[model samples]
Target chain A: MVKQKSLRTLVAAATAALLLPASANAETVKIGVVMTFSGGAANFGKQIGQGMELFMQEHPEAFGGHTVELIKRDAKHPGGDVAKAAVRELITREKVDMLAGFVFSPNAIASAELVTQGKVPMVVMNAGTAWITKLSPYIARVSFTMWQSGHPMGTYAKETLGCETAAVGYTDYPPGKDSLNAFQTGFEAAGGKVVDAIPMGGPREVPDFTPFFQRVKDAAPDCLYVFVPSGNHAGAVTKTFADLGMRDAGIQLIGPGDITQDTELQGMGDDAVGLVTMHHYSADYDTPQNQAFVSAWKAAYGADSTPDFMAVAGWDGMAAIAHVVKTLDGEIDADAAMEALAGWTFESPRGPIMIDPETRDIVHDEHVHEVVKDGDRLKIKVIDSIAQVKDPCKALKIGKCGE
Target chain B: MADATRARERATAHVVTAHRWRWVEAAPWLVATGAFFLLPDYMTLGTQIVITVMFALSLDLILGFAGIITLGHAAYFGVGAYACGMLSAHLGWTEPVSALFAATLVAAFVGWLSGLVLMRYHGLTLLMLTLSVAILLQQLANTYSDFTGGFDGLTGIYFDPVFGVFEYDLWSHTHYWYALAWLAVVFVVARRIVYSPFGRSLVGIRENALRMHAVGAPVFRRQVAVYTVSAGIAGLSGALFAQANTFVTLDVLGFTRSGIIMIILILGGTGRLYGAFVGAIVYMVLEDELSKLTPEFWEFGVGLALVLVVLFARNGILGLLDRARSLLAERGR
Candidate 1:
């Protein structure tokens, strides 16, 4: 009987010893990534994923002593319903510590309530709608708003390009309206007048720009400012602009960088050359940090794939998340994570960036880039730089931003 | 005298059996109620599933029973969502029930007007027209960004307590129950309509519209009536969704939504009254679980399941059960 008791005691001691390691090291942080992984905008997810992965590999110390696990769910589309459902499941079922990767404004907006209710910090990677950060205190953005680029482009067009008047043609949606407002306000503030503003169909399909451009041509604005959601729309606009011979007609092609998105720029060929626009990041940025990032991206992905602004946003978003994780020491309280991100500054490939404490939006340099053809490839060359440009919509207390 | 009395008794017994509530019918509702206790963490998903079930049931009323093949039933759903959403956001109609009713009426009226053109055509032409209607509405919403929010989605929507009692909670407990109650009421009404003579005539029209017309059944009028009713029910479901989510996107009118409901009905076995309930539950659960298991490739699993169901269980899961039950009875005999 004594021998049997001794054996049982030994077994019990061994079981406790096995369980101690599991219980002692329990600082695992699960981040739920909700992004459109399928459909026309699927490249957004692929680029964002590449950026995040590169950041994680390069900056392992960003996570401190925590074991970080990524739980990715496909938003599928930008309708908001699918995104909301995915977010609800991630919070309620998976119980993720943080959330990130929203590529569309509507998807991010629909998830505001869920993140607020779940007490999880959400880092917006690519959704650039200005008021999204204000929707929930738990939300923070690394992506630049439309106003961030549009407003600066407007000022550049008037002061540098010597365009006295501009006409705006944008996809009829919230982001499009935001871009229109941004450019118009900046141009008018800089003593330039907006002659005409046309709402060109919706964003779901690429509408023919013949009639709209003809109307603008008739109005004869000194410069034409256009905004369409990036990808094929940018290619279409460039083709239409060239086809209509607007440049030869003395109306300069100028808008935000969305018109010459890096992914679609090569397809536009010579038509996109000499087009001047202001934006945050370009693949052709000649900074050492950007060079390293671009090389790393090429090494990681492929030589054929180009990292655009969306990719940079994703990389910076992960950097912010890592900072929060390190600061909180893996005991990631929702409020503390948000506190760590507010007013946080980091040197990104795009240049130095800071989260504005007042508005919870991104603040970075807006570079005026001129598309130039070099060796049969289109490249954006930085001509002028507007340093530390804040989101003018929030800074100026615009309509919805005020509330 | 004895023979006459026996025939009358037989007819009465048959009527009673037709109207009787089977124990099996109650099982699904019981399981749904049980989910409230068992799935506290899944209330949001529960609310979504219940709302989807209601929407699928509405589609079944037309496509399943009336045999009206529509590719844009989401048109009515979108109208309902926009009406309810705009009413609350703009017109200050905060009461959920009243707003739902108003939205239903608006959807039904739109359905009636469209039915004039839609009901006259059949096959691919009808399908194309329905798809166009949905696309046109989506564009209209997109064009009018000020009112519909235009792809950014409708915001600032607020709902008063349901029946001035139950408030929509963070856990979505109220949303689930509210949707369930509406589902129950709609289910009962739909059940009655399906078993009635009007419902039988719809089936007859589906089987052979020429024969139904030869019998003086007024095929076009019946199609229009049933389509309007289905649209109203679909609108109610959409209103419930808008109130529960407190937001609406152009997706409400997208082709994807219309296709999803049709797929649910097909998977659950169309023309079967309880098919919507089963199909919705299975599809929702599978989608939820598969997405969790494999986020990137979950659609492949769902597609595989659909192909299998179509190949083996041609009538759906219910049909498979029916065939099994008959085989067992034959063996017993």
Candidate 2:
């Protein structure tokens, strides 16, 4: 009877040992990454992934003794249902601590419900629509929003660039619409007249931008302030502007950060030279931190592979995660991480980046830059700056903003 | 003795048919109901699969049984989604029952109108005509950003509750059952439609429309009716999608969406009612699983498998099962 009792006790002890590992295995902080790593917007995800890798390699101690585990799932750019499915899988299946990465607003909106419902702290890496921040309480953005950079460009174009009458054109999509509307709001608010707002094709359609450019030329404004998102549109836009001879015609062309992205500069060459645009980060930032980041990036990915603002935003996302680990003593708590990120201010390569307490969006400097030839490579030269831009959507009189 | 012999033969034949068909028919639904309890953790993905199956079923009704090819079935889907989205978001129609009916009617109405033009063409012309309508609607949605919420998509929309009892949540526990019930209802109605004298006529038209016309079948009118009915089902699927996802983007109306559904239908083997469910389950689950397994996952394995299915199992996965059943029966005899 004593031997039987000992055998029963051994069985019970063995069962407990098997179950304890699962509960006690909380030493690793896992970030579920749902990004458009495939499909049309692959570049953004690729760059962002690289940026996170660079940060994780350099700052092992920031995790507060826990190993950072990243479980990535592809949202497929512009994928709606897939994004939701990914978030569900991440939260329930993999049991990830936090979530990050999205480039398009549509995908962000789709995943927002799961993020909100699960109470998972999702650090928005690049999706910049103003409405995205309002979706969930647990969401925090480490990237610049369309409203942040676009609204200030309106002011810059009118007050600094001295644009009296401007004709507007934008890529006909959600992000493009937000960027243009914010720019127009800021421009029109500052006593500058918008002659015509010409809409062009989206990613699905290959449209001739020449006609839209011709329409802008006919309007004959002081400058044509347009919103063109990155991808083939930016390349087509720079070529169209050059082909239409708008620069030679003495009508200046300007836009938001998407048009003058560092990646797009490769195709723009001389055409992009003197083309002014507004953005959160310039590759040519002269700060010591930025210099280190650039050097590290160059060392990791040759001299030709440069970093974009989206990549910097991804690095900042990891920085936010690091702060969460530091603040909570390496424990991954959703509520604590969200609370820490809501109004957290940290040193970024771009500068001192602060998340707005009210909106939970990145409140950082918006720089007005002109594309210039720096040696063999073309890069944006920061000419002017807008200090601490908050979300323009929160200040609106109406609209739910998807909340 | 002669009458008794004939009766005995009929009974034996009926039993064999029941064994092959009825049990086979109930298996998928029974397995799905059984899986509901087991797959609690994957309810969201499961719900999405159920919705896609419902969508594929609608396409099978037209493209598979009726022999009509369409590239823009998403038109009805978008219409239904927008109808639900606009009503719930803007007009304050919160009742799920009312919204579903409204979405169905709106989709059917649009389907009827487009059918008038679409039925006049054949082959590529018909395909292009169908595609054009969807594209036009998408462009209109883009142009009137104020109403449809433009490219930002119509946000701030959500379902009230299922029968004012169960509130839809992120876990999709209630949604799975709610959608399953709808699927069962639609499946029954579709089965009746496809098996009826009218369904036989539609199949006959698919085989040879000219011959069907000569046999006093009103080809165009019958085609229009079936298409409209199919559209209503697709709309219901779309309305459920809006309810499930709680948001509507222009995605429902895109050519890619239409193309994917078509691929699902073809992959599952067209003409069979059960094909849609199998196709959706296999496609969606594989897509969800494959995408997670690797970074380079692009449904390439799915594409390769589809090519193999078309080359080998001409009818679909169901066809392979049908062939196996017949072979087993032959051996048993």
Off by over 4 Å in 1: A1-26, B1-16, B330-333
Q: List the residue pairs that clash in candidate 1.
A: none
Model 1: per-residue Cα lDDT over A230-333, one tens digit each: 76777788788999999889999888887777877888768888888889999999899999999999888899988999889988998998898778877889
Chain B TM, per prediction: 0.95, 0.92
- What lDDT tens digits, residue by residue, belong to model 1 across residues B61-157? 9989888998999999999999999999999899999999999999999898898889999999999999999989988998787899878899888
> What's the lDDT of the predicted structure labeled candidate 1?
0.87
Q: What share of the true interface contacts does each candidate keep?
A: 0.47, 0.50
Looking at model 2 chain A, which ten-residue stretch has the lowest summed lDDT?
A: A5-14
Best DockQ goes to which candidate?
A: 1
DockQ, 0 to 1 scale, candidate 2: 0.42
| Local lDDT at A43 for model 2 | 77
Candidate 1's TM-score: 0.92
